[model samples]
Target chain A: MKTKKSLLFISYEEARHICDKIQYGEATRMEQIKLFIRISWCNISRKYTQKNTQLTTLCQSANLKSLDKDKKDSLKKMLESKMSESKD
Target chain B: MSSNTLDPTQWIDKYADYLYNYSVSRVSDNEIAQDLVQETFLAALKSSENYKGDASERTWLISILKRKIIDYYRKINSKKGKAEVRMSYNSDGDGDGDWMEERISDPHGNNAEEKIQNTELGLAIHECISKLPPKQAKIFSMKTIEGYETETICNELDITPSNLWVIIHRARTALTACLEENWF
Candidate 1:
């Protein structure tokens, strides 16, 4: 009779074969899930970085366009106030 | 970001489909899988500074995504506090008890050879992996499916070497048992 450990080891090899199928996209649901996650990640990351860059550019441009030093200072002060409020 | 910067965009084209398919295999939900992928990308972008180029960009991005998925489950489970309740399969209109019975059926019997042939063994294995305990399943997928090294897996999971091995061993054992009973 085969030892229990040997039986388990054989079973593990079988399981690994099944997993190999999944890794290779031979599995249906597994393939779908992997595809969905990848697309979602790409979409989200691209959008987030794009949005952040746009916001940063807008901030910079607004700051640069301000001719009045007093207005620029006030804008900085407002940003500081908002930052402090967020901390609170 | 500078226009001259090498866009990781090329990486997305090559790895996005593969990665998304991998995530979807684990989560079994399209929307959530998509969200996880997006989170992975956003993480890569934010932490692009920390990526030391030791691993391929694909590997690094996947590591981040895996962490995000774990965090999501942790948050959800904390609020639910009822693991048993979530274990059942009710949302698909199939009774949980019946589903469990089906899940436990052997697919590789002499008469069931056709079923095994028609139904891809890989898909069956994917389902079996999905049924594993949450942490074990994640660890197994990261190691077995994603091909991450033990050291990287431990670091990403914040687990000790022993803990990682234990989880992997258990996960493999459980999957094997489940497959033997249900498929082979």
Candidate 2:
């Protein structure tokens, strides 16, 4: 049985590092457990995780506008012409 | 059905908006997005013979566009000199990752505040990413924004997993600092 004294409480640096590994799915099971234990009580690390999640979601959902019709038509003409040139 | 094959001419009208939106979201540059979509069309035409009709034309085009975007990142990074990836920690020499503590705080707010904040938050994030040193920006985008797997990123950028972790850590910390200065 793992003794309470032997259950290593990680440092802030280690906890953040493991949090990153967890984000990338790179942490080992034991590392994940340690990270979870750390974040459960560590408000700072929990905030880090929340910010990381927010950043990832913001990036994934970045709403970018599309080209207008006139621009699309011109680009299509250019590409089609280039296609024909390459074919010949 | 008048035709069994997808008409190539109709691709722009049918899929240009989709391709543009996808490209712009990833790259966040209108000209590059337009160029990438055009390149996708050209590549599709070049590889038209490879189309077996198993996937719809739109799917095939998207696949090509995705590859094009990856290639664009690879090509741009290739032109810069290959520097060894190094860890950027606090200059105080503690290596504790404590440099970010002063700069970042909880950005959370009431729902109305969040709604008002998120628009500029998006622009701030993009601006902060663009401010990273070129290689870090590229690697960060590939790993975080583009969602490339870690191993693939390591192989493509010729860095180890540990090195990537350090770079990503630095990038995120830098972004937090930037966001604090600009957004918060």
Candidate 3:
């Protein structure tokens, strides 16, 4: 049981590091279990784990669309002129 | 003659939206994304003579855009007020230990309300990152947003793994506290 206990239990600081590694897909299964066990009792670490996951997900889906037609046109015209100037 | 010399004017109609979306995702600023996309086109024109047509026009434009984005981060890092911004964060006593004040339960992450909240939090998170010391911000985004491997980041940024971890932990702590203030 000594091995099991050491494998599952970890300090908060260690738990946080494992949590980050888990998110980054760098943690081993043993480390992931340790982090899960730690977060079960550690509210702060649990929140941190949740927030970190949310932040990454948000960023991946942060595809903000550009809808400024006028700006697009002006930029196009400016680029065209610049290109022509370079040619001449 | 080879048809390799792609016309510059066609880029706007063909790739502006794609390029703009890419830039905004990286930089998280609409105005700056627009400017960068435009700049990408200009760079393409300046280097037009180098178009050997081995790559597609879109591919060439994207290469130019990627360089522009790197330059944008470098420019921000070299800006004058970087030290002032870093000093604004409380770096005196216990490092980021003070940021661990309170923690709430995990919110349900996939419901409609949560999705809406994420949209708002996306902007807030970007703002939080921008407020960090420019170096921390750059490294954090490179790690998280760009998903660079740890060794690659350490080597490219010329930082040790421990140094990278410290910066990331601090950045995450500050961002958590900031998002809680603004969103939670």
Candidate 4:
């Protein structure tokens, strides 16, 4: 039996995009509902959602903080000048 | 010989954040952490020729960073001298003891086991991030780790919101897959 195509249904690709958005809290309520429905019976989408959720949890608990842009830029410039000086 | 080499100029571009995160977790100070990363890069540069391909570039740099961190602690300890603790007895024979705060667990210090776990997790995430395409890596880092706004990232990267989303989706998928094996 084939699952009928309907306007209300979302494709697995869109479901994945929505899953990514949901990770960042950017997914709208409607998108979340659609994703919820899609993965309810879709095995592939469900597996993707499970892994995506696990990834989000790992990132949150990692407690990682990146250096700001200014620091990174200055560090790069300092290394560049040092490298050039070494060659000379 | 295994094939691994150092690129001095890409040191900051590639490993600055990774090294910074590792050092900050250990040193618990941002300024000192940044200094250690810079010193590690410079030291690596001075000894670039001596680098054989036995270890990956990141691993070799980390070895140097570990030394820098240890040296930092040693210098501070030498400057301050060995810690002296004095447990005093009250002259009137009342209760007196060592520093009261030292007797208590530090609330702000965070639990040691959890901190160690987070540090390891953070390092793993950074390692995977390093393996991503340059643009994808930058966008993902800015959006996810640094928590930049979508519009802000788009304008900075000169890409539209949709394009940003596409890159993020790809990067996230790739990152999750990579981490699943190494981390989970």
In terms of DockQ, which candidate is strongest? Answer: 4
TM-score of each: 0.33, 0.46, 0.49, 0.88
Which whole-number lDDT from 0 to 100 does residue B30 have in model 2? 86
Task: Name the 10 consecutive residues with the lowest summed lDDT in model 1 chain B.
Answer: B1-10
| TM-scores of chain B alone in all candidate structures, in the order given | 0.45, 0.47, 0.48, 0.85
Cα RMSD (Å) between model 2 and the true structure? Answer: 21.1
Q: lDDT of candidate 4?
A: 0.87
Tens-digit lDDT string for candidate 1 (B104-156): 77766564564334234444455565567767866766665555777888897
Better model by DockQ: candidate 1 vs candidate 3? 3
lDDT (tens digit, per residue) of candidate 3 on B1-184:
5565686766665566567766776787888998899788877888888899988777788889999999999998888546665425556666665444413333454565665565555556665665677678766766776677889999987999878877888888787778778766
Q: B126, model 2: CA deviation in Å?
A: 1.8
Better of 1 and 2 by TM-score: 2
Which candidate has the highest TM-score of all?
A: 4
DockQ each candidate and list the results: 0.02, 0.15, 0.21, 0.70
Over B7-74, each residue of candidate 2 has an lDDT whose tens digit, in order, gives: 67777655665677667756768899889998898888878878888787777888999999999889
Docking class of 4: medium
With a 3 Å backbone cut-off (N, CA, C), the pairs that clash in candidate 4 are: none
Model 2 chain B weakest lDDT span, ten residues long: B102-111
Q: Candidate 2: lDDT over CA atoms?
A: 0.73
Off by over 4 Å in 1: A1-88, B1-6, B82-103, B106-184
| Deviation from native of the Cα of residue B184 in model 2, angstroms | 4.1
Judged by DockQ relative to the true structure, which candidate is superior, 3 or 4?
4
